[model samples]
Target: MVAGEPFRMLVDPLATGHCDQWLDLPETSRAGDAAALLDLLFGTDDTLDLVVLRVGTVRHGTASRRLLRGGAKGIDDAAGQTLPGHPRYELIDWRCPVCQTLVWRIHADPRRPPECPEGCGPMGMRRTG
Candidate 1:
């Protein structure tokens, strides 16, 4: 799937902390309930970076600090920890330049630039109405 497409993601609260509740969130829920859930799970936003890692048929976006700390290699490590017998997974990190929006998809291709949802041009033109 291309970036900016709406998708559902399963969150493992326990991965970030000792929580019994698991969250399944829609794309729109990312900044609202999902953000709150991440805060609760990770305890700090510093380590709450969203990384979409695919394992078999399931694609999950887990909160990880590896990306911020370890960069590309860290992403590989984070994917490895998600499931057994896998060495690495694809990473989606595309964001809209105009609005600074994180673009997400079930299977994201980073090569594809995300379109601004607010219709902001490449120059970030704002709507007057």
Candidate 2:
């Protein structure tokens, strides 16, 4: 650690607030939507203080916010309302970084951390355009 260097805690939009658990905010939205959300919520700020003090601070990120404001009508109404391309259930394949081998495929909740069969723990994969 360096002296005078500020500490920061970074979390995706979902962690900051469970995206799917909210009304009309589908958990299966596209990655671009999530990126847009992160942009709107945490566009730019300082290390001294964060604009979002709590969960409800940044719920108005245009599209999703509009949905939230509309409120969830009912279980039936919200049923099958996920993003067009997103499947109701998505699988995530975790891999071992050291061995560069595929590991296990599981749900994308992320609350459940996946481990490498070879004890490599978890590694982040770079996204390629």
Candidate 3:
């Protein structure tokens, strides 16, 4: 170890809350709809964080906070819904970064990490996008 050359602290996967898990959905439905998809795919595997990563590009980036309403309804509703609606499940909303466009849909398996559809790179075992 050289003296003060440089020391980049490594972030442990567990410590950083990375390497999360989630159940992708066919569409970007309401929170409720998304949850149902999770239940179906994971079957009670709630140990992982559900991150809606960027699927494609958009003219403007919306905010997650704004998407949610009462008691985190938009986010929590997924726990009690079946499928999402049109606007809610639109690809424009689920933009894919690599493709530089919104994805038609994405349904990741809970048991496995998802791969990049555009093939720009692998969806590494990290939590955050």
Top lDDT prediction, candidate number: 1
* Predicted structure 2: clash tally: 0
Global local distance difference test of model 2: 0.30
Span of ten consecutive residues with least summed lDDT in model 3: 3-12
lDDT tens string, model 2, 12-50? 233343221211123334333332332233222122111
Sort by TM-score, best first. Answer: 3, 1, 2
Model 2 sits at a Cα RMSD from the real structure of 16.0
Please estimate how well model 1 matches the true structure, expressed as its whole-model Cα lDDT.
0.34
TM-score of each: 0.27, 0.25, 0.27
Model 3 score (lDDT): 0.31
Using TM-score as the measure, which candidate wins?
Answer: 3
Q: Which scores greater on TM-score, model 1 or model 2?
A: 1
lDDT of 1 at 103: 34
lDDT of all predictions, in order shown? 0.34, 0.30, 0.31
Q: What is the lDDT of residue 123 in candidate 2?
A: 41
Q: Which stretches of candidate 3 lie over 4 Å from their true place?
A: 1-17, 27-31, 39-43, 49-71, 74-78, 81-129
TM-score between model 2 and native: 0.25
